[model samples]
Target: MKQGQHKQTDPDPAAHVSAGSLQGYKGLTPALLTKLAKLGISNMQGLLLHMPLRYVDETRITAVRDLRSGEQAQVQGEVVHVEVQYRPRKVLICRLNDQSGQLVLRFLHFYPSQLASLKEGKQIRALGEVRSGFFGWEMVHPQYRVVGDETEVATALTPVYPTTAGLSQAVIRKWIAWALSHADLSDTLPASVSQSLNLPSFAQSLACLHHPAPEADLASLESREHPAWQRLAFEELLAQQLSMRRHYARRKHQGAPALKPSKTLITALLKSLPFALTQAQQKVALEIGRDLEKPYPMQRLLQGDVGSGKTIVAAMAAMQAIEQGWQAAIMAPTEILAEQHYQKMQGWLAPLGIQVAWLAGSQGKKQRREMLAAIADGQAQLVIGTHALFQEQVVFQRLALAIVDEQHRFGVQQRLSLRQKGGQPHQLMMSATPIPRTLSMSYFADLDVSVIDELPPGRTPIVTRLISDARRDEVLERVQDACMQGRQAYWVCPLIEESEALQLQTVTDTYETLQQSFPHLKVGLVHGRMKPAEKQTVMAAFSAGETQLLVATTVIEVGVDVPNASLMVIEHAERMGLSQLHQLRGRVGRGAAKSSCILLYQDGKLSEMARARLKTIYESTDGFVIAQADLAQRGPGEFMGIRQSGVPMLKIADLERDHELLEAARELAERWLETEPVLVDKHLARWLGHAEELVKV
Candidate 1:
């Protein structure tokens, strides 16, 4: 037997064992238990083993004579009067009387059926946490039972679990009770494994978790000091580390033919640039050149904040690939972004007579066929487009490099498809999101990272201002002035159309309003619901200055670039994440003209978190600082919907508190993989299994 477990044998094992298990509760009705497996609960054992999020200590009971202020207690007393308090909301108030004192039992939103259950002048037992008010003692939603049924009044510390709206504490407790009664007490782990780790068996742990007989039993079940959680956490980290290592190893085996850029050609390209590159940019270029010289393909990430000249750096890398007599391709996530990159590349690389062709979803069939032929025949030296570049028909002759824009948007399979073309191409993934160095190292350790921290010359810092609705007219006047100056402007709305729940201002409504405000100006609209061709047409008009003002959704956040656009207005800016806001602001400040971003927010009802986010935006335009602050304000998991990013999901390893643990785990994982490639040892194997389960991969 485990050291601190209950030693007493059941007086009547038959009485202890009950019938209604979770398996039994599955009565052909679709309830939480029916859908439990999808959320990782597999069996009755798994359901009962799910621990409570917190515990409520409803164990304190006292007589009316001993009742004190600011104490939580259950008391038995006679009822005096039942009345209803009607003010902000309806509440049921029952005044109780005892030998020495009186107290009020309050229930928020109590129904008539509840009042019918209790009779005045009848003895009753009240179980509630006490709060001292100005008039007297009050307990809200206190558990009540008949005076004679004292056993039913829960006097022990009760478990309170994380629950959905339809599930309540009583229902969960009943389910747990059912599970405990039907346990089979079978051990899943091998005896040798359990002996080595000195861990409890599967059945034993489950039983203890449901009905902990002692404090030690509860602690052991919680796995707070036990080796179970550590074992689990380690296992999760190891699986990710191993998966990354395997991917890296596989890439290395692809065999990249060594190709070095000609010194004279690279020197000529660098000298011909309009301005000298920043030191940080030069450092990154050198790294890329060095990687190209190696026989192994380069897999690197280029991360920079908004307006950090990342496109220029990418162009230089493509130039090097051209010098090596091999073709290069750049893939953007959207056609708009691809078109933007194509235009930028044409303006910059066309002077050198380097042929560049764009192939996207909207390309003409005959034109696409011709471009594909030129690419396969080694005529087009550089190709830039959306996913069209990765299609099976579009082949590359000796493709040497691939540049992926907005790397997060493309999945691993999509990126691999491009690299696998003709030959495994050297990869450079770029993101405008500035990830913290440590997180980047921990999350993307498999890939090398280069950051651009400097902005190019003549780029003006965008002034961000927060305005209340009272200043709506003033904001509109400013936008009107910016548009009248021959410079274009973008007005971003939160939603495409109206919805019942959100009440947010829609882009269509905003477009109509703005058109009336500026009668002579042409207004173009684009949203996710618009057809691709329609979107392209509107975007093209905006780019060519046919529409001086454009109203758009978040779709334009990443790639539609118009250098002359000097004004950006984002409505309900507080609703956006910091990274999203940064990307939106990046749309402007691409030109020599001064740009200004105005954030319009509702008055008087902003949440604390929303206010903080807006304040952070106003304080600085530094993306790195904003990223760090975002992590601190909302932990990495919640910074931007943890499900979307690959950041490790942790229960106890707080990103803020346990950063040290994260670093330690990273070093341990890397060393273990480097030394012991396979998880040969029993300890490491066990750890790997636990890690994989925790990450839910």
Candidate 2:
């Protein structure tokens, strides 16, 4: 995105020139508008923000004689010959000469207007990739225009934009050029603020980006290290921060019923637990307790490493609400994970006279009805399920607290729907995939965060070993040994397309393979495609030690807890992301016996990225360290774990690369929201456009 030079004569440095709407532009057709809408652009602000993916040096022309095969070049010459041929295929051909040499212009697809435009003796300028054809050194379908010798070339590099199916670079370029010339290219940040942050003026930045001088550093531009790029990145980051803070404030003002803890159920549950709460768990639970006691709504993200006692902290938070006679609901992303939570909640609370219900899509009609009735009547004090808990039929009687596990797996609307299930319920979002520090500060700025940095005292440390698939038989023997030693093992298949059927097939095939190798060992197979009852049966068997080995997909990545299961084998480890591999590795190392995770990667076929990821996971058992490496390896977008459908994502700024910019934006956003509300409005309006409301939501 770019703007032109601003005159000091303007009364306000933050003066905004509205470009109005792209609909008012006579050059763009209705059909083109529809296509642009698919790309999330519908007006001038969006057009101004449409950045170039790359640029071409079309400012000069190469001599016809100097043309080389496979080089993209622009050449000018007189059209001396022309003809249409129909031998193997109908084609139009033209020959041009510019004194030193001759060049052939080939067009396989042509119209009569093109033929008439390429008449002999007309000087033509053509640009495209040069390649060898039947005629030596030819350019097929080269863009050309009949010209006079006096015609001058472009002063700036031609911009190529990211476009959709029916859009053209030339058309987008034309619109952007018009926007640069006409749109209000004024600064949104105050001059004092930009100067303090060492950022460039908005107008200057836009001008440099849209029409860089011919001698500009293209590498700097392409890599987005140029000063102009930083300026735009800062603006976008600022808008997001402001939007988040405003949303946070808006929610704070919409007060909720404070779920003050009577400590009756909590004290009972704590006394009955087999283990005491870790210090970190107690600290975080206290933080959550303080937030829930406030009259305002609590939107907190509870982050902890895999198997770091987050489940108990969530249970502790739920008891606070339940003690006040209000219902509490916990939603997990998958049925397997949800069922585990249900079983645990049932085990912990059922004895304390607390009713817990399970809601899932695969439940039988009669069972689902009973669960629904219990939830609606407030008889079920603690409810846990997959996304089904947020469905229309399941209404909470007095829902005061909502806990979501693996929160990133849910969509924006799904999360929002769950929030709306109660009248401003306090929300607790739990994640095992740790958020990188900078990401938590910037993208997740709105939510209060509590981190359980300490693991429980008695958990065993996991040893990660990388082994090639070439030694598959050796790895199989290791699994057999572990299972035979009175310990359980997990053989996890790679997630194939994230489709339930495909994942089921993957685990089934793996199950069959292991069945032949270990016919004596009882192995259980579970996947997302199985009915809830069926999955529960298999998981129950594994938990009860009836099954010695379990072969499953990533469904076991989060909530399947068997302290006796100490060995984890992840197939195609090279194909998985670092955080995913880390989570999978965490499935083991829960018991006192020394645990080991074998990363079974294909031999001699690992890509550089995959190799780096495997190495990162193998080197560190610390979730935060692995998380930072994962962020660097995959970039913040993928590392965020939330899908694009959840929120408005960054367009220019990268959470890893531009963290300094983000930090500056974060500090400035908080200060300006109170001291300079006008500037914040202009900046958010320009950068956020139609996304202002979406980001707030």
Candidate 3:
């Protein structure tokens, strides 16, 4: 072998046996066990499933002259000088030379043993990115070891595992090698299913991924686009689908009130509205109406664009349940939104002999007690509130329908707790934030989906404008013009209290500035810090056209529908997310007047991500297109909040890249579940060990 080449061996023959526990190995200590436990590696299978974050190519050695700046390479050379300096900072510098060139190695932090090993005149191998330093080519904090006569280089790429502070890469590699030799690496999927999908065997894929040969496609391995990676990703996605399906089946076994569709309240409510329901709304209302008639629990997600009229659909669903003598509850993520629902529903239902009760965290003890009593006595035919609806003290006599608005903003546990208030109550989740197709296939595979794809008639499309903060004076003039024209406007800011670190405009400051600039017009302010009554008062004035210009934070993002608010000017729009910007823009365009949204971004301060978000929002107003772009940019983890919730995040799958695999897995899981019960059980056991948390939500 010239260099960086060695003999290879076939994968161990223990592949037919299943993986065993970590305790089966000898020479285990308490300290090592604690570390392994912390990493969640209690068995040999856990070690194999712990994939590498990235791979380092240490399979080749380049000559010193061939080292390129900004490229990583390993070089063998003799150290000619070694010194420790203490000037601007304590440092150790070594000069190494080969026949082609001299290389400098600098370490800001070093060990005494490393100094002894890297003495002058010692031949060593160093691997790191080469960069241009003051002293020609250099590498900082490179991995270096003394060269010995019997030393052999690696013929395969090296893996950098996700490790804890105490667990070293060497220890993990040693344990994995042992497991590869002793544990069974059999395929979990059946032969027919695996062959139908054209996926590789589990044992072969694992071996190839862990020890990829030098000739293996380096780019594919690093980006996880290789077939070996795809095979594992498919298995992981299949596991997730199976888990969700199983929970969905369990829900199907439970009994619900079976509130048949009643037209008594539905007809009255529809006739009372000033406008008729859109075709899309009527269609989704029928879908929800039928779901309410099923004995099994209904878990449906009603999604639509902003101002698409989801609240009315939810109200229709609640009316059906109430007409069938079952109470309904609606929960919102914020006090502002919850109060909005309470007021609107009370207006529509109170005259129809329906008692709509209100509950919120900010309510006084006496008010809360009265609300709770009404709910317990079943006197509150329709209950609307914030997260207080799920609080333990607020008991519901008969809550058959549970509606959650802006559902994605809530954690899984909060939603689950509300459902537990009534035995197997039908759930109707509404969101203005559209879920992309890939996410609908993966994260929300279990639920039935109904999309109100059309906006009600007379609602004008919003004309989005991206303007630099340097032109903010023009935007202010536009806001003043719109307000003077007998229409309302919203000026949204990112922060409420002063944040010097961010140094962006705050709501109070903007409110004061607008008041000073336009003395004749009313410039009211509302933020999360305001008391609920104060916010309600300010918002009521704005909704009634008393406040011409409202300076607020994102608290007005969802469910604050003002038909006359025809203009929205968001300050520091670069600091907001795409969904948030879209929602804020939705605050306008609810009325027939031609609406516009001005995004005031600091041009010089815009990052590439902020620029992309603003460009996407400015170019298109379609929620689905914007949702796709947002998903592609932020990914499903941050986009759907899989990392912070009760759902189990995928171990080896990227929803963006492995969407095809997700589709395949979903189909296969459904088919296998219908026919191959034993095989499904075996595969789920292999993938989801003690994953009770996935369904607890």
Candidate 4:
């Protein structure tokens, strides 16, 4: 029979079984299945599809005498003795003896039920690492099987895979065996496409991967040009590219009504600022002003490093809407940040006689109701707050533009929800994390990018220092010295409390320690779990100088601007992602005061990736440079935990390695979708459908 058309002995798929299925297999319970499902594996096909990461070559058996001290080998011998060692650590020791020599199989922490199966005077085959013990040769924690009709199978090379907590390797193997026996293989990719791609038949690849006839087959799988991996990666990337292309094309062609700026009002507001706008700020602000005048609503991303004067650019955009007799809003990720922006805008824009309102969850019900009424009546020209802006109660007279702060913090759905408020609003997604141009093209291709690469003049570069935990006292003393001069300080901790799994400083614990050490200094604490109002109060205390030091979590990483704050101490700094560290460091260097950031890390051990990040931060103050290095060190997936950022996750395509392929796929999709528009061809529709599914992953 042809491989792809294999027929099952039983016509009923459910009635079929395999050689490995036991009438009552031990430990095959419903709980284990549920756990496996949580790991993204479900059903018989999933069991077989989860291929082994690697395979061990046990085809050649070695005698005990032939085993070297550091080699991994399979040895066969007759069981001479079996003993249970119950002293220091529970272990089951089995000794095997052949004509050549003696070998002991030690199983540490073995279950009592397993002892009955391993008996004395039984011939068995064992696979493990060979090591020298006091009694000579030994195999530690090895797999073994008693002499049986299928003993020859034990001598063959075995596949090893990554499994979850509750699933055992043996159980996974048995389930895969059942799938291989019962599953009716069907070819998904057409023969013409396979031939054009120089790919193997789907059935042959799957079967060869599961049960390779020879070691050469395994070697072929590892090659970069392997048909299975190449095809899978390409398909996954193409799907995502197609979705992005479609979205881009749709947005670019959509007609948007643009509003003209009110020069009188903008001039009045700019005159009230305590400081003059920088040249970089003026340029970006003017660019935004022009975009607002077009027939199409602006959908732009403002990319800038930390402290690169992006806040002013956002203000300029908001001013344009206000001048055109429309409302504008800025959405921050957190309440504290939202409140901070509200206070700043009130101080700057309120002087121009422009009405501004702050809407957040932490506000009193009466206050929120009043703000909503004001917005609906067109009394509020500018509004700033958290996600609460999208709630149905808050209506705008003319919501022309929406500015999202730290854009990555919210997902595409959340951002869309904001635009969907009233009619579609022009979006300006702003991010302080400077991503390289190449990576940004793949990740944010849906928006037009405007980068403010140059920093505002007179902004001092922060002095960075890497200090081991052993020098904690010196760092604390320096912080005290800085605070003595009326400079505010931020002590950032990795966690809120000590964890058994992690050895890092917690915010609450650090706050308590710092309070005790500096009794005279006022200290305020903030974290994610705190109520929004409470967080705002503490942040206000810090800003008002009621608190000289603020011990907080990374919640303050974005949108909390205190120009007078010049000192930053990050505990367990090496544990943070590069982008996170940069944001934390950015909390300082805002004011004219010479600022400094102390990265306090635990002494001794550090992973290579962590070391690279710490070194990069110390060597450069440029966020773009740091971002590029971070991307190279850790792929985009690991860089920011993209899932939490509301961004779609890529499965097989590496943003760093497959960037060129991603671009090509995007180009092809854009050209095809633009030219054909509807994907009328059946094959083309099928490809487009597959690509559409990838955009959401």
TM-score of every model versus the real structure: 0.74, 0.91, 0.93, 0.81
Per-residue lDDT of model 4, residues 502-539, tens digit only:
86767888999999999989989999989987887898
Question: Over the stretch 1-697, how does candidate 1's per-residue lDDT look in tens digits?
Answer: 0112222222233443321233433331356664454444445444554566544444555767676777667787788888888887888888888777888888887767667656697776787778886558878888775464344544345776556655556655655665666655444234754565555665555444444443434464354444443333333444455555545655667677577765655566667777788888988888887887778788989988877778878888888888878898999988778888998888777777789988987877899899989899988888999988778888888799899998877765677788888476788989887877555644575778899888877888898889986788998898889888999999998887688786788999999999999998898998888877788899999999989898999999997778899999999887887778878988899899999999988888799999988989889899999888787776655553444544334443344544544565566556665675544233333323333312210
**Best of the two (2, 4) by TM-score:** 2
Encode model 2's per-residue lDDT on 244-319: one tens digit a residue. 8888878878878797865688899999999999899999999999999999889999999999999999999999
- Models ranked on TM-score: 3, 2, 4, 1
Q: Which is the winner by lDDT between candidate 2 and candidate 3? A: 3
Task: Report residue 631 deviation for candidate 2 (angstroms).
Answer: 2.5
- For residue 35, model 2's alpha carbon misses the true position, in angstroms, by 1.7
- What value of lDDT does candidate 2 attain over all alpha carbons? 0.85
| lDDT, candidate 3, 107-135, per-residue tens | 99987877888878788889999999998
Given candidate 1, what's the lDDT at residue 86?
89
Which TM-score value belongs to model 3? Answer: 0.93
Q: Which ten residues in a row have the lowest lDDT in candidate 1?
A: 1-10
Residue 438, candidate 2: alpha-carbon lDDT: 85
Q: Indicate which candidate wins on TM-score.
A: 3
Query: Each candidate's lDDT (Cα)?
Result: 0.71, 0.85, 0.86, 0.75
> Whole-model lDDT, candidate 3?
0.86
Number of clashing residue pairs in every model? 3, 2, 1, 1
Residue 326: error of model 3 in Å?
0.9
